[model samples]
Target chain A: MLETHDTKLTEDSVRQLVREEIQRAFKKDPAKKQACIISSKGTLDWAYPPLILATAAAATGMDVSVFFTFYGLNVIHKDFERKLKVSPVGNPGMPMPVPMPDIVSSLPGMTSMATTMMKSKFANKHVASIRELLDVARESEVKLIACQMTMDVFGYTQDDFIDGVEFGGAAAFLSEARKSHLTLFI
Target chain B: MPDIKEDVVLDARNLLCPMPVVKAGKQIRTLEDGQILKILATDRGSIADFPAWADDTGNELLEWHEEDGTFVFFVRKVEEED
Candidate 1:
């Protein structure tokens, strides 16, 4: 609040200015600075969003939490190299090194080849690798929550995940999502 | 162009979308409110990405320009009430 030497200034106008300032302040509420993302798909192509968004959001000072469930467990799994293979079969839109038919994409070693090609393409495009993004997310303090029920169903123990992974369930995720203004399922 | 100074500079050239913005965001936090962060990136997509990121993070996008093939942006950190 500053002094207004103008004789035209009114008391009601001063109150209005304060109200507007409060509204502007509320625009940056802490709740709005929260992001809760759910990772449900495990494939290499599908793995990027949750990690990328979580890391990106955290970089901007938002409190971020990523709940990994179902096949998404592959993202935090120790064998991510083998677990995060992109299947070329039935994915006609996926660009290929050579124009190959669907049958060729389904042949043995195709998934591994496709994953390798994708890794190289992403690297060439200067996109951060998934592992790098994961590291960034962790460094930025974005919570990595793995679903306990899914782990049990898939016969995965806590030791199967990388360090700093938290085990939780649907309620845990909802608790965070309910408090966050930004929620995503990817 | 008019003279505009920056508090810090980040070279994000060769880094793609999200990475440039992410690095800028991380660096901006180390600055005080109203301090400017200058970024250099080669990703054409950063033309749209930086402004959107600044808006999302409640920071002020002072200005942007291109130098040769690089996209340059200046952002001011907005200190939110915690």
Candidate 2:
């Protein structure tokens, strides 16, 4: 026999209870904050997100690692300064202090000019440089991994990369990725 | 006028948010305990950023000031006592 009482849990009350339970559950099963960033492109803009996010993650006291594969190796390579270049021919989202028409943006040499302007703006606005971000990552002990398979494909030797970079592959990344609560492919 | 170290001058002029703090974070670790760092930055956000960073990282904010165009910050490396 089932006795149905005239009782109803209000939506707000139910929500509160659920939130409390979730909080308690999370506290009990505390997850480690780990992130894996896979950088596949060699562009200047493409370089920023991984470095920024990795550094910010380290700032948040998380275990962060970056896996540079293919063209991404240029970012952490010794010749990065010369290898990395901004190309306006394809980048539409690149901001300009003064708005320019697509034609102007698509024009030759616009990328170099735009790159210079953006770098200067970054400097003027106190935006951290890629070099500085890398230094921060290093200081914070963020692990940097260069994809071994990609290195072989690209014919990059160990000397091609900056110091303190480890060589690994997808399996290595997945091993870390499985433990991480946050994983990003950029 | 803040204490200056032989090798720890951070020229953050024309840089912005995370950049200033990021640079300061990197440079601060290189300095030994009690060594001072002078940060010359144009990023206005650093007025507040460095103080917060100092607190979080256990470094000491010795002094800070702004002049005609640049903001100056002085921080002392406080060793993270084991």
Q: Write the per-residue lDDT of candidate 1 for residues A53-123, one digit (tens) a residue.
A: 88878877789999999999999998887889898899989987789899878899998888998999998
Candidate 2, residues A95-139, lDDT tens digits: the string is 667777778788888877877876787776556778888888888
- What is the DockQ for all candidates, taken in turn? 0.66, 0.23
TM-score on 0 to 1 scale for chain A of candidate 1? 0.87
Candidate 1: Cα lDDT at A15 = 84
- What is the C-alpha lDDT profile of model 2 across B38-67, one tens digit per residue? 889887877887887787567888888898
What TM-score would you give candidate 2 relative to the actual structure? 0.64
> If chain B of candidate 2 is superposed on the true chain B, what is its TM-score?
0.90
Relative to the unseen true structure, what is the C-alpha lDDT of residue B31 in candidate 2, on a scale of 0 to 100? 85
Worst lDDT window (10 residues) for model 1 chain A? A1-10
